[model samples]
Target: MPATYNTDGAEDPDLYAQLMTERYGPLRLILAERNRPAPPRQARANLTPDPRAAEHRHQLLEALNNRPQPDPEPAA
Candidate 1:
């Protein structure tokens, strides 16, 4: 049998949203969240920075810019 909604994969937001809500269920949230009001944001974070963030950033930059990088030293 032919597949239904073969071209209905996110190309058209309206159709995709309908299909998602129907095929999933009323309990399927986030679909209804489309173009809706912004959910409340947290006032502040209780998070700490990862010590390796700098290293990861340098590695990502080098990879994206097509360059090799030396090991990153600890930040002051």
Candidate 2:
């Protein structure tokens, strides 16, 4: 089934506004709120570095350096 039921005709915009105002109070206040500019967003600054990042990098470097080496050649 369709989500919205088919209506015979389009609803009157003014009547809809009046109904909404009756239910929710003043349309002007609602319209003003809807049209108002949003508050400015705050910029997030990293005040401190992550301590674990350095430890992880150190562990990775140690693992890379400690890889197995080839055996030394025997006398001919």
Candidate 3:
């Protein structure tokens, strides 16, 4: 979906405010208004170390080593 922004060059105002309020109802609108940054991406650990902090390190390595399954076809 395309992001909306004010054409009038205003920085502090939300361009999608009215539409978001109508679409998601009021509480979501309030939460959206808070304008928080998105959460950070998760990091993976190096599994080659002798003393592994994770007990399931081998399982994790095995899962990573396996080939990824193909994505399912989209609905018609």
lDDT of each: 0.66, 0.70, 0.62
Better of 2 and 3 by TM-score: 2
Which lDDT tens digits does candidate 2 get at residues 1-76?
2222223354775566566567777756666677899998868878788879989999999999999989999989
The predicted structure with the larger lDDT, 1 or 2, is 2
Question: Rank order by TM-score, top first?
Answer: 2, 1, 3
> What's the C-alpha lDDT at position 39 in model 3?
85
* Residue 35, candidate 1: alpha-carbon lDDT: 46
Give the worst 10-residue stretch by lDDT in candidate 3: 1-10
TM-score of each model, in listed order: 0.31, 0.33, 0.19
Q: After superposition, how far is residue 50 of candidate 2 from its true place, in Å?
A: 7.9
Hey, what RMSD does candidate 2 come out at? 14.6
Residue 70 in candidate 1, Cα distance off native in Å: 26
Backbone clashes in model 3, listed as residue pairs: none
